[model samples]
Target: MAHANTVLINALRRTANKLSSGTSYQWGHMGSCNCGNLAQELTLLSKAEIHEFAMAGRGDWREQVEEFCPASGLPMDLLIAEMLKNGLTTTDLQHLEKLSDRKILAGIPSEIRSKMKYNSREDVILYLSTWANLLEDELLEAAPSLESLLKWEEPIPIPEDILL
Candidate 1:
């Protein structure tokens, strides 16, 4: 799973919202597909820019992710590196492209999950929104509670000479 963080969660949600508001979407287009929309949100790049970047590679998002080399400096690789730096994992990209992450899939309601088609825009929206919610939950679970904060290690001593 990708690291639980607000950046990834918000980007996922914004991408879903963009799609819901009728952004261009096509499973066959590298710039407008599932991962492409997210790339747009994360990289602040347009669909045309994403498509141009992807053209530097030989395969689709899934294949590129599988073969990613952060040090390679290819435009697509660099774009992918941006996403990873912001909290996404290569596996997350692969699953986003295919809508097949087991945990993300399980997070969706069973009835709706059963009907989700990987390439459908509506299904992609569901997947992204569900992913965002999952990450948000994970982030909340990982945060230190007030009780834990109150119990945090010994406090630093104050100098008596300067005391008020």
Candidate 2:
């Protein structure tokens, strides 16, 4: 699962919104595909730029991910590096392209999740929203309470037995 952060969570929602509002979604298109769209949101790159980077490599997102090497100067590798720097793992990239992340999938309602088609824009939108929600929950859970943040250090009370 992705490490939850506000930026990544917001990006996921924005991607979902873009899809919901009819942003171009074609599973076959390298730039507009599932991972591609998220990459766009994360890296602030256009679809054409993403597509071009992918083309410089030999395979689809899955293959590119499998072969990802941060040290390599290949365009696709560089692009994937940027996505990683934004908090995604290679496994996450693989799952994003296929909507196969079990954690994210589990966040969706069973009825809709079970029927989801990886290539369908509606399904993609739903998946994105669910992922964002999951991340938001994670972010909240990890946040410090106001009392904890404002607390000052206190003296530890030694156990009575140890003091004796």
Task: Give the TM-score of each candidate.
Answer: 0.92, 0.90
Total clashes, candidate 1? 0
How does residue 16 of candidate 2 score in lDDT?
A: 95
> What RMSD value applies to candidate 2?
5.5
TM-score, prediction 2: 0.90
Candidate 1 residue-wise lDDT at 147 = 94
Scored by TM-score, the top model is: 1
Candidate 2 regions off by >4 Å? 153-164
Give the Cα lDDT of each candidate.
Answer: 0.92, 0.89
Pick out the ten consecutive residues of candidate 2 with the lowest summed lDDT: 149-158
Clash count per candidate: 0, 0
Looking at candidate 2, what is the lDDT of residue 111? 87
**Which segments of candidate 1 are over 4 A away from where they belong?**
150-156
Which pairs clash in model 2?
none
